[model samples]
Target: MNFPRLQGMTEALRLTQAGQLNDATQLLQQLCQGQAATGPRDATVRPRRVIDLARALPKAIASGVVSPGPAAPRATVFNGTAARPANSPMPAGAAFHALTYSGPTGTRAYRLYVPASYRGAAVPLIVMLHGCTQSPEDFATGTGMNVLAEAEGCLVAYPAQPASANPQKCWNWFNANDQQRDQGEPAILAGLTRQIMRDYAVDARRVYVAGLSAGGAAAAILGAVYPDLYAAIGVHSGLACGAARDMPSAFAAMRQGGAAPSRAAAGQRTPPAIVFHADRDGTVHPRNGDQVLAQFGAGLGMKPERQDGQVPGGHRYTISRYRNGQGEPQLEHWLIQGGGHAWAGGHAPGSYTDPRGPDASREILRFFLQHRMA
Candidate 1:
């Protein structure tokens, strides 16, 4: 027996028992890699166990450690860099305020951006949700949505998900409780949106939501559960609503395409949707982009009009637009040929963003402004 290796495994188990999952996972990963490279290759070496441990790491942390219910709120400081360019100046009188909203569901922190152009007239409002391990400021800086919002004279709100809720600060889109209407994270998010509307002159007809990765998945759930509130939804590198009911399934859906979205309850309309996914994305399968569009375009009997384009010195992409009988576009899907698990055409200062792809922020806003509540 390799006593030193066995000792390392025992320590890893001890760390897991102590609830130091991050440290345990790291140690296991290192051990597995070293064992694979240097350990004896005899049949007695039990290679299958090592592989199983590696595979179970994410699932152990996701499903075993965290409960599906709402976690007690923890105060987290905003420490991420903003996506604003040094050369660009904030419009005079424009402000980004950090605020909190408390409702029947719970209390959550958020950041709102009010453009200088606002002068009491109702304007479009966009609710931006950040992905796992991301702060609102980091997401803002990465996607440059604030910059575009300023130019477009729109109010942008970013809801913060604290680490206390999930160690990774991820929205629990996979949790069944979080996927329902007027319940869990959905209710909190919707309440926050309503609060913003009441406090500001928001154009109810033009309200929209967009997100990346886990936030993208949450945005899909919000659109499905509250179609009346959101004119449209943009999901980038995300799964469809009801994609997974738990952590194991969420990981499965991210690896492979998720199962078909559950049918919406009677009287609920499927909100218009725009999706962006990179063909090369390993974190969330590219097929999920197709699934999101399909969920919204189902039963519409509309065929998509396809267009191919390339970014200047960057990636090649294909755009498919699904139009209604009256020629109104109800769904749009963008597939970046060589993109990964990052925001396409995003700024470098923020995490999980690709600067060379098509400008997803500008494109999503363009798609959003085209639709309003009917």
Candidate 2:
């Protein structure tokens, strides 16, 4: 098979940058066709790269910026700037792969991103969870978070929700099974954290979790049940506790087929939190977002102190930050006035996403870096 030429890939990237979606897409298809003809040795890898490019092109077009085509045919488009001007050297970081571990049902998968800063020295770890029906790779691209992690000198892990857990791949945050003591989904997630820590120099004190929608609720549960494991948490366009009662209720709540769950144990240790939501979010009620802010604010014995700020495109963001005391670092609440139930300023490549203003990924990373377990 004829492999996609390096020059063609570079040109496609240029076209994408120029907002030429059709041309970029056509080139991607041509690249895929070329991969189909490659011999067995390189055949397997090429198609994967093609798929990555295919999935990313639409988003690049949506964002009005040309995308860097996939580095590997079948793999994600990380470090695609590999062929760019050598002036800006690539940072040294271990390229992570999908790793599987056991959960209640069967095997679960997650992707890890470690920066060059992650030498033998302990470094902060951030777990970025995806919303319903999303994969780790999808979240990684849609959120553009790995770049932030690289900039911040941290390790990023994306926990995946398998279809077996929920048809929509929503984490069972609303389920009693997922939130229980030591033997449920919480354990499984924490186990993954431990495994990553053991395999890498993870700074226990600086561990954090952030998620969107269903994944956000799961991050809340992680901070609640395993406070010692995660120092901080971020929830975007998600509900506060009391979104469900049991597994059945959880399922119903997720499908929007039932009411919110009853409030569970508030848990003793409260990890500092940052919440992001759009006042106009149609899918997840903005009220749910308020409840989340209220819960964490109250935990710190305070209320949200509002500040005014303007984001790109002159979009105004109401920042409600809370703190425990004088010495405590503040937690932020961003109520994007006209934003939707999506990552703020994210490309609209998938459903349940809003591209209104500030980048949630960058804000979440900044929030994670501020606080640690006391």
Predicted structure with the largest lDDT when compared to the true one: 1
TM-score list, all predictions = 0.81, 0.69
Give Cα-based local distance difference scores for all models: 0.77, 0.64
Summarize candidate 1's per-residue lDDT along 1-374 as a digit string, tens digits: 87777776766665554444444555666676775222222213211100011122353343222111111111111112233461266788999999999999889999999999999999999999998778999899888888889889999999999977877788888889998899999999999999999999999999999999888999999998899899999999888988888767776787677888675566677788999998877567788888888778744688888999887667789999888777888889999887777787787767777777688888899999989998
The 10-residue segment of model 2 with minimum total lDDT is 77-86
On TM-score, the candidate that comes out on top is 1
**Backbone clashes per model, in order?**
1, 11
